[model samples]
Target chain A: MSKIIVQGVAQGTVLKTTSPINFLGAVDKKTGVIHDKKYDIFEKSVKDTVLVFPHGIGSSVGAYTIYSLKSNQSAPVAMICQKADLTVASGCALANIPMIVVSNEEFNSIQDGNQITIDTKSEKIFN
Target chain B: MELTSEENAALNGEHGDTLQTAYRILVATGEATNAEKLIPIKWAHLSGVNYNTIGDAGEQFLRELSKDARVKVKATVNPMGIDFDHISEFNHIDDEFIKKQASIRDSYIRMGVEPTFSCTPYDIFDLPEKNTQVSFAESNAAIFANSLGGLKTNKESAFSALASAITGKSPYSDLRKDDITTPMTIRMKMDNPNELDFGMLGFFAGKVGDTSVNISGVSQPNRRSCKALCGGMGTSGTCAKFQFIDSEDEKSEKVDFGKEEMNEVFDELNTAEKGDIITLGSPQLGLEELSDLSKMLKGKSFEKRCLIFCSRAVQEQARTLDYINEIERAGGEILSDCCTCLTPLIDTNETDAVTTNSIKGAYYLNNSTGVNVNLKPLTKIIEDETK
Candidate 1:
């Protein structure tokens, strides 16, 4: 798959969600499972996986939720979004989670449960 | 991003670990936004105070940050999860939740934050001089500082605002200059405009997305009207600052709105039925609003639960002015430093409906709490409650 450099790079199995997540309410802090009822990924565990989504929505406090995930040792190993806003950027920075944005075509090429390595240092994603 | 020698030293860890991390985050954010350099700021207002919203992870992060670093500039904080004085009143909030919330407050206090615990810092704090650069995180407050106060501040994230508070600097970028202030024009034509009309106008504007908008036709809005407008706009859209043109002036494409549009917005936001809880002060009530509410509540009693949330400073003033007595006498509760949307103080399951004067509160409470909310004017809510 074609690679892009948006933030940092890491590799994990993909956990995809179609809806934009508001991390503050969407994810359970202690369990790391998607709890927001609005999304199809409800009850899916994001722990240590490369969480993929379209983008982040809702409160800016979602940034802190991401940090809390790391503090609880329940954070996704990495993140990939179609677009990255301030909330996502701040969360990744604070949590030290590697994240990158990809084009729609590249994002479409990847599926849930796929093994992938996103490398920002080399500016590539290996599928 | 270009950094000065001092900035470089901080980034290089010569200054200290806290400064290094702060500067690094700022630099990264600046680079991401194509900011050429960082500018010094005199003030910073931070959000993300509620323990229910931030949870344990947020508490730990704040504790760690405060251990090594303190804010360099004068800073104020947003609301906590519960009112410290009225803790026993909110039985729905457990002791564990209270303890975690208190820790977050303590960390900010230890960091030398002003502990204002308010979203509407402009009402209590000294208004920044026009063009004064500041870093603010609360969307309503940030937009107010930018649009109404004539101050310059981009809508900051909680993390970025904390970073700016530590270093007293923010990346010099969007909404900081006058040259880039022009936005898509939204012309409002209202007949006999009142407080509710202003609120609906904001609700409509916010739905317009990230497009910078200039609102024309309304002139010289009072503090509460301005608050309602900004709060509604911030809730629905991402526009940070909106220009106000009192008189007709051709600058950009304009969308004219009238009373019909206002009713539509009111209809859309007011989803709950009568006899629901009446909530005020989503952005936290200002002094004038409290005074107005007190006047409306004189010789009147509420049939349903009415909660008025404001800052400690404002509450103190209201108490001194005997407004608190009037509100309490009328069977309304005054909650300070917390509101329904930020905290789990109110049990949503027990609450069948909610009537609020704040569009922001209605929107958030509906989504986060899963309670039916009716957005209405303060006058209407008071009248309904009294009747």
Candidate 2:
């Protein structure tokens, strides 16, 4: 298992999406399902998993969507992105869902359903 | 991130939970962007008000935050989901959606935000000093403040802007740095440029994907044309700012666009065969635009639905000048606060197609609503719809 230091801490099974997620149009706030039909992860629930993606795109309201997910008790346990735009950063912070950015190489090395743990205090991710 | 004593205290929850949360988000954002410190800001403009966009989750967040959080600086809010004054007029919309929209406005007001409810806050508010640091969330307003107003702001998200409003600070990075603000050169030479031509130029620049662009060769542009240009650019791309120069400036690489290129852009953006509904004011119309629109509709009455959206401030001014009455008499409905892009007040299913002069409006309506949008000059929309 490879380990790397990062910004926020969490442990969960990974659910990866190759394409970027736009939470505003791409998410169903009530159910936490990925509603964007264009992506392979469409109809997947983000709840209780390590949601991994390249980054977020589209409306800034995405921050609120993430907050809505958390409020509805349907938020992912953790998130790992190749980069963190303000939308993801702010959203994750507000939702209190741990998030970290990983290098593309490290991100590509992992597969869906792989159990992972992130420790922001220790600044490390253990697989 | 290096934190000042006050910042450290805020992060440590010495100030309050609201400030602590704001500080934590700001610090996290700063870490992501590699910002060294947080800087004080003069103003903060927030977006994410439309219930159709933010939904229930956003409303809960605002409600909770507003209970204990008061803005530290001058802050203005973006448009609500519906026109509050004429709520009864829009009987086509759902009562639940209207209530959500009203709650958004009420929550922001309780948080001490000015009820501007306008995207083009620069139009009504006094201009900030040159190079003044501010925080603005709306893409078009942020671009305009940076490019035209000569103020400094990054394209902020709703949460980040609200954080800045509460804390009176923002992560110092990107547009705040003077060295990175220098733009690359993209020269444009157009013959007899109009508002539509300017919008096309902005669309082309957005397609280029350059953050900072210095454009030359455009003749003196009026405020409305400039607004259209910046609005289109911000909508289509992530450009922070653009500078316009005279035709004689010979120091940079230039791209020249003519009538052919303009027509190509129009073809790409126009998806409607004929417009069933005509909508305007994506960034919310300025007083000048309303005046011109009123004049254009003087002798015309449309059988199809026509909606003109503006801010409460501008709407009041238009009323004082009798422009609202003339537009209404000509069979046009004037809506305030929200526009076609942000709200579902205008049902795409009810109308076969939509038309607008606003490039931003056309793009968002087409993408978000799955509606066919027709891109035309305002004159053409008026002429075709009236006939």
Candidate 3:
């Protein structure tokens, strides 16, 4: 069963990474592109996709960066994580973006470019 | 997470949009962290004040929130782009930067947050009672409060702390919980480590360790050195809440911090053999460091430009103690209400490299500001750069 962190329903292509994100340094706020070369999905745009990652890492400004993405209209339609950290959770809540968490088994089952739907009210994430 | 009737009401938008937003954030954070309920916090020290860090998006966010949100508890802010009192001194800051920075300040003030634009809040402000929960967004302050000041916090983000300030509550999880234990232990193999050495050790520890680190083999470090450790740890990685242990059990996973590890960090940060200018205070120098610097430079003057960053209160207090005068007499510029990290004062085009005693400052200057850093100890900097 998938756990919903933020309440919303959205469908988008999956942009998955095994690496934990630090939104403050990893993502470009204006372009919604992953800038950190260390990550698996480097230089890929996060716009209007399902941002799937392990979790978030980094300092306090990271939350604001996530909000910046939404403000700039470059935000992911929804986010799915194997775990939820404070930075991503707070940002997702503040930005009013849908967020969900899935088990490790389920996380590995999803792949990049897959069309996924996140329905928080129903607590379901399906392709 | 279970919420009280008042919290539920706020979440339901009965208390206005600001409270509704705050409660929603808190509830989400609590649910994610597996916190059973939201606990009231004594204070919140936020860090989104830097215009360079937040840009227009964060400024707009605060501007909108300021219309209705007011801090329920004591809330302190971090440093902005330029020190408003000393605005005319720095040529790098433009009118637009000043205007946006001012807007950010106005928003915080309108929300009833204190204009204490200092990173070392634990140094200047009167601390709350021991074990009291607080929300701190400044990384160094959070680490210092947790490890040394006997206060508890989870090293909150700017948004999380702002939300906590508005609601007077934080999710009781991670470092806030009493049952938390140190997952990694580091044993030092260095002999008589200086402040910079300790900072290197801390930077290494933050990189390798987990949520909490247990460090052994350091005996009673001074205040400035302790601050350096916190600052360096806060700078390099996400590990928080380090404790000094005299001894440890055999079952614990241990890491060693030695000469090789120290050299690796030093080599990584200290890219320049010499620098055009010297900059200090990533955590912002407190009164103790100022006093030490004043004593060190009693009969000497810096051969090159030396910029010292400290809090306004600390700077004023140092002036009263004759420390600021001595530093200024030695050709050091005392920049208050701001530190070296992400400040616009240090222009990379004019100065290709910067010499700094703070490891945290070195990292940010090299990575964010695009300047080569010359990392040195305070004593070495004074010895080599002054005549």
Q: Which candidate number maximizes lDDT?
A: 3
Candidates by DockQ, descending order: 3, 2, 1
The true-versus-predicted C-alpha distance at residue B199 of model 2, in Å, is 4.1
Please, what are the lDDT tens digits per residue for candidate 1 over residues A1-127?
A: 3233235767799999877777765787777888756579888889989998976654567778787888888999888887655566667777788877778987888899999887788877888
Q: Give the candidate number with the greatest DockQ.
A: 3
lDDT of 2 by residue, B106-174 (tens): 899999999998888988888878999998887778889998898998777778888999999999988
TM for every model, in the order presented, reads 0.88, 0.88, 0.94
Summed over model 1, clashes come to 0
Query: Which whole-number lDDT from 0 to 100 does residue A37 have in model 2?
Result: 62
User: Which digits, one per residue and each the tens of the lDDT, describe model 3 over residues B202-254?
Assistant: 88887777668999999999988899999888766667799999998577899
What order do candidates take by TM-score, descending?
3, 1, 2
In model 3, the runs with Cα more than 4 Å from the true position are A34-42
Query: What lDDT would each prediction earn against the true structure?
Result: 0.79, 0.80, 0.87
Q: Regarding DockQ, does 2 or 3 come out ahead?
A: 3
* Candidate 3 or 2, higher TM-score: 3
In terms of docking quality, model 2 is: acceptable
Cα DockQ of the candidate 2 complex:
0.41
Whole-model lDDT for model 1 versus the true structure? 0.79
Better of 1 and 2 by lDDT: 2
